[model samples]
Target chain A: MSYLELSNVKKSFGTTIAVDDFNLSIAQGEFVSFLGPSGCGKTTTLRMVAGFELPTSGQISLQDKNLTYLPPNKRNVGMVFQSYALFPNMTVADNIGYGLKVTGKPKKETNARIKEMLGLIHMEEQHNKFPSQLSGGQQQRVALARALAIRPQVLLLDEPLSALDAKIRLELRLEIRRIQQQLGITTIYVTHDQEEALSLSDRIVVMSKGKMEQVGTPAQIYTSPETEFVANFVGQINLLPVKVVSPTQGKVKVGEQILQAGKFGHLNGNPIRLAVRPEELNHGFIEGANNLSGKVEAISYLGSIVRIRLDVEGNPISMDVFNERKLTIPSVGDDYQVTFPVEACWII
Target chain B: MKTKRINFWAFFWVVLAFLYFFLPMYGTLDFSLRMKKGVLSLLAYQKVLADPQFLASFRYSAIMGVITVIFSILLFVPTVYWIHLKMRQLRPLVEIITILPFIIPVIVYVFGLIRTFSGPPFQLTLTPFKTDILMVAGYIVLAMPYMFRAIDVGMQTIDVRTLTEAAQSLGANWAQILFNVIFPNLRTAILSGALISFALVIGELILGDFLARPALGPYMVEVGRDMAYQPAALAIMSYALTWICLGLITLFSRSNNNQRQILGR
Candidate 1:
């Protein structure tokens, strides 16, 4: 059995459902990310798991113990907020020692634990400073230290790096993953940043409008999205509307070309979407492969790579290629042919 | 040149507004300080401070102001935080109720409070604690509008919902979250509103005068009938008290801003 299991969990405020029939199982020591845009119920799910929010219906079990009805204080879960939520009135040491104090731990042990936590976060020197005296990154580290000092069964992070600048966010993302791994704590990280989710999570759960769209490994989620929403949301994808030409063989007709997408059961003479990543499309047309003829609409120079936008049969398709030393920049309105292997096309 | 012209006009308006507000206060201070004969004696201050009734009234008002601030915070903070956490949809209704005191004139409410408390159904007015209770109740109603607004703004600024959730996830219960998390963060707002409420209770005349309460405002009115310079002195004292409260608020806000700046760095 999974260490943490949420089955058919639902939550609603008035008439609006904030989290809908959400079901997930997190194995012990697994780091999962709830990845989606703002208001997509990622934070809500994390709150439910942390016992900050009660599920409107269904059950949440941690380590085979029912946790849905338990209050946050009794749940033994720790969460770091997006804003850091460091207690401004308390010094770093006091903040880190809060959970231990609340649980009635001995002063000597709590002090030792607080000292160890401060050292763990590399903030031992600043333990006497209040949260209002710390920088944003430092405050975030303190929050992390405080949450971890509790020795929780599960750790929850609600976009913990969202408040930092890009450089610090990147640095903390790796730090958080390293700590999660080192401690072997089951963690659920909620974030809207796709790259952060991809880089940090053992598995990514993509949500939309309070519903889980898809859940898979990073590579699986990026390469083979179950729906057009996941494909479009997880990364930049060129979604071209196509007509299914056959059912037995994955054949689809796009504009004036018939493309074979290999054997796939879902495509059968029905209206479908053909999704392809930009990196999969090459600059020159290849024989015996899915090919499209189009005019080069625009070319963006991005240092090491060139992004080419093509207007193929009235549909815009983008392709990215490494910048060659001796290559003519494709001008707007210039005719060009683009090709992609059959396996790159995903029918959604 | 255009920017300079805008700056000039802005500065002129600011100075004009300050003069318009402070000129009368300056006149009151000058009048209170001047001697009627030829010498500059401290006669006005002496007369105002020497009266037994004046001293009693001042103590009464200060005590009431402290009680009002305490009661207002006790009643409003938890209610507002609860509304923010649970019944957010009822915020507008709660806000309306908080400002009801401001909408109804004090004279009207005082009349209602006295009539209701003096009758057989509730003969609270006959008791010794009646005056204290009535005064505190009136002040609570009077202070709610400002106190609630200040707290609401503070709550909004910190995104109270998010903060409460964050605190909860850290294993804090309601009491711990309120005293340790929310209240500490709301210190500046609570202080500012408490100061305003304190000043308001100290200077309020209509309710105290109508209720026949032996408070500073009623004491000032009683002295106004017998002596002119004493009343002027009392007014100056009240103004000074308000100014001190405002100064404390300014100091508190400045320190909070500095702390935020240091944290931002």
Candidate 2:
């Protein structure tokens, strides 16, 4: 049995469904992220798991125990809010010790746990200071420590790093993942930033408009998205509208170029979209399985990589190539031929 | 050039407003501080401070101020929180009701209170406890507009729903969430509203006089009618009391503003 299981979970607010038929089985010690844009129900799913929100119709079980009717306080779940939600009046130590104090633990044990929690977040020196005295990053750390202080069975983080600056957000994301792994706690992180989800989650659950779009390892979700939304949302992809000429051998015609996408089970002489990642397209003409001649409409140099926008067969396509010392970069208005591996393109 | 002209006119109007507002206060202070012969003397202050009636009124007013603050907090803070949390849909209606007391003239309410509680069916005016209860009811109504707005502003500063959920997830019950999480977060708002309510209770005149209670307002009216110099002294004392309350509010709000800046909100 999975450690934490959500079966057909659905949530609705009046006429609007916030989460619909969401199902996932999270294994023990697995760090999973619900990744999507705003209004995608990622936060709602996290809240349902944390018992802050009740599922409209479905079952949520932790270790084979049904927990649908239980209130949040009895759920033994911890959550870090997007706003940090640190108790403003309490000192760091008091905030960390809050859970222990609430559960009627002994004073000595609560004190020891608080000290240990402060050390865990590297905020020991800030124990005496109020949350309002801490910086944004420090406040977030304190919020994390406070949530984890009680050793909850499940840790739910609702975009905890979204409030910080870019540099601080990156630093804290790694720190949070490290802490979750160190404790081997089952964690559910919710975020809209694709890079953060990719780098941090063991698996990513991409959601859209109150429905689960796809669930897979970060690599799988990025490389082979099942839906057009996922492919477009997970990363920048050049979606070329195509008409399938043949079904069995996987042949499609885009503008003037006839392309073979290997054997795709779904496309059968119907108009479908093919998604190609920018990194998969090459800059120069090479005799390959899949090749297209196009004009370089625009070229942007972004320090480490050069982004080239091409007008291929009257359709716009983008390609990202590494900035190397020996290679000649493509200039705008230059006619160039680009080639990519057949397996890299997927029909959606 | 147009912008500069607009700015100049704005500054001119602001100065005019300041003079219009403060000139009466300046006249009142000058009149209260001067002696009967028109020379500035401490005599009015000394006479006001020494009178037994004036001392009783001050003491009663101070007690009522503290009582009103405690009562207003007890009644309004949780009501506002509940409205924000569960009855969010009813917010506009509740807000209208809270401010209704302020809109209705105090004289009308005072008359209603006296008639409703005087004898026969209610008979509340015959007993001191009943009369005190009536006074508290009046004070609550009088203070609701300011108190509700203060608490509402506080609620708007933070995501109360998210904070409550966070607290709940951490094993805190409703009581813990209210006293520890929600109330502490609302400290600045509560203090500000409490200060305003205290000042209002100390300075209020209509309800207490109509109810025939020994509250500060009636006591002040009695002294003002009988003693001329003592009333001026009492006015000065009241001004000092109001200044102190307002000063404390300013100090608290400044610190709260600093904290908001630190949070970068």
Compute each candidate's TM-score over C-alphas.
0.89, 0.92
**What is the CAPRI rating of model 2's predicted complex?**
acceptable
Q: Which residue ranges in model 1 land beyond 4 Å of their true spot?
A: A239-246, A251-258, A271-275, A283-295, A311-316, A324-342, B1-27, B30-36, B209-211, B260-265
Give the per-residue lDDT of model 1 (tens digit) for B1-265.
9999999999999999999999999888877877466766678999778888889989999999999999999888998888888899999999899889878988898899888877887786676578678889889899998999988877776657766776676677788889988888888889988999999999988778877778898788888898777788888899899999999999998777633312223
- Considering only N, C-alpha and C atoms within 3 Å, which residue pairs clash in candidate 2? none
List-wise, what DockQ does each model earn?
0.38, 0.48
Q: Residues A284-347, candidate 2: write the lDDT tens digits.
A: 5556578888888998888998899999878899999888998687677888988888999878
TM-score attained by model 2: 0.92
How far out, in Å, is residue B244 in model 2?
A: 1.5
Please report, in order, the local distance difference test score of every candidate based on alpha carbons. Answer: 0.86, 0.86
Q: Against the hidden true structure, what lDDT does model 1 obtain?
A: 0.86
